[model samples]
Target: MDMIVWAGAVLSLAGVAGLVWCILYVMRLRRKALDDATMRSRMQKAVLVNFAALAVSTLGLMMVVIGIFLS
Candidate 1:
């Protein structure tokens, strides 16, 4: 229950939220009637966000593990 663990937990939660957002966004995107160009553009943007969220979640889990070991 160190502060680092708490921080990590928060970071992980935020990443999860972002991931959920990406899911919802993709769902909405699928429902849209935009052309291929616009869809691809939006999908690329979503990919970036998805990767960022994954990275953050991984970093958070790493931080939690490191904190536990250090504690």
Candidate 2:
């Protein structure tokens, strides 16, 4: 139980870090003066990655909550 809680906490933290990175990456992309096509493609990729990271973070948070309740 304690191990599960620890793992969940670690995963949650990692997910948060990933999300932060995604935000910064998108911000940097927006600031760049890329051509239309390249900018569009990069934006699409960034959106996908950001959504994935958000999902991971959400799941990690849920797991942590569950672990806490269980233990």
Candidate 3:
């Protein structure tokens, strides 16, 4: 049970880190003067990664909640 809690915490933290990274990446993109095609490609990749990170974070949070309740 403790191990499960720890894993959940780690995963949630990782997701938060990823979310922060995505925010920073977007800021950098905004500051840069890239061409439309380049910007679109970069943004598309970032969006996909961001969505995955968000899903991970949500799952981790749910797992944590379940673990707590079960324990």
Candidate 4:
């Protein structure tokens, strides 16, 4: 159970890091003043990453809860 909790914590941290990366990437894109088509293309990729990060975070939280309950 403790191992599960720890693993979940690690996963949560990774997810958070991914989210931060996405934010910084978008900010950099915005500063570059790219054309609409380029910006849209780039933003679409970011959106995919953002959703994946959110899913990972959610899974980690669920793991943490289940670990605590089982313990």
Candidate 5:
């Protein structure tokens, strides 16, 4: 159970890091002043990563809860 909790913490951290990366990526992209079509294309990719990060974070939280309950 303790291991599970620790693993969950790590996963949560990774997800947070990914989210930060996405934010930075978008900010940089905005500064590039690309065309609308290109910007939209890049943004679509970022949105997918953002959603994946959110899902990973949610899974980590669930794991933590389950670990705690089991312990």
Candidate 6:
């Protein structure tokens, strides 16, 4: 249970980092003034990263909850 909690913490931190990255990336993109197609392409990739990061964060939260319950 302790191990599970620690692992969940690590995963949550990783997801937070990813979310920060997505924020920065979008800010940078906004500053770029790119064409519509180009911006859309980049945004598509960011959307995928955002979804995966969200999933990881959610799973990490679930793991923490489960660990607490089991302990």
The lDDT for every candidate, in the order shown, is 0.94, 0.81, 0.89, 0.92, 0.92, 0.90
**Model 2, span 1-71: residue lDDT tens:** 67767777787788788788888988999899999999899888877877887777777778788888998
Off by over 4 Å in 5: none
Candidate 1 lDDT tens digits, 1-71: 59989899889998999899999999999998999999999999999999999999988998899889999
Best by lDDT: 1
- Tens digits of per-residue lDDT, candidate 4, 1-71, equal 99999888888888898899999999999999789999999999999999999899888888898889999
How many backbone clashes does every candidate have? 0, 0, 0, 0, 0, 0
lDDT string for model 6 (1-71, tens) is 98898898888888888898899999999999899999999999999999999989988888888889999
Which scores better on TM-score, 5 or 6? 6
Off by over 4 Å in 3: none
lDDT value for model 3: 0.89
Q: What does the lDDT read for residue 65 in candidate 4?
A: 88
TM-score of each: 0.95, 0.85, 0.93, 0.96, 0.96, 0.97
lDDT of 3 by residue, 7-53 (tens): 88888988988899999999999899999999999999889889988
How close is each model in CA RMSD to the real structure?
A: 1.0, 1.3, 0.8, 0.6, 0.6, 0.5
Show where candidate 1 strays beyond 4 Å: none
Name every residue pair that clashes in candidate 1.
none
**TM-score order of candidates, top first:** 6, 4, 5, 1, 3, 2
Q: Residue 23, candidate 2: how far off, in angstroms?
A: 1.4
Models ranked on lDDT: 1, 5, 4, 6, 3, 2
Q: Considering only N, C-alpha and C atoms within 3 Å, which residue pairs clash in candidate 3?
A: none
User: What lDDT score goes with residue 17 in model 3?
Assistant: 89
Poorest 10 consecutive residues by lDDT, candidate 1: 1-10
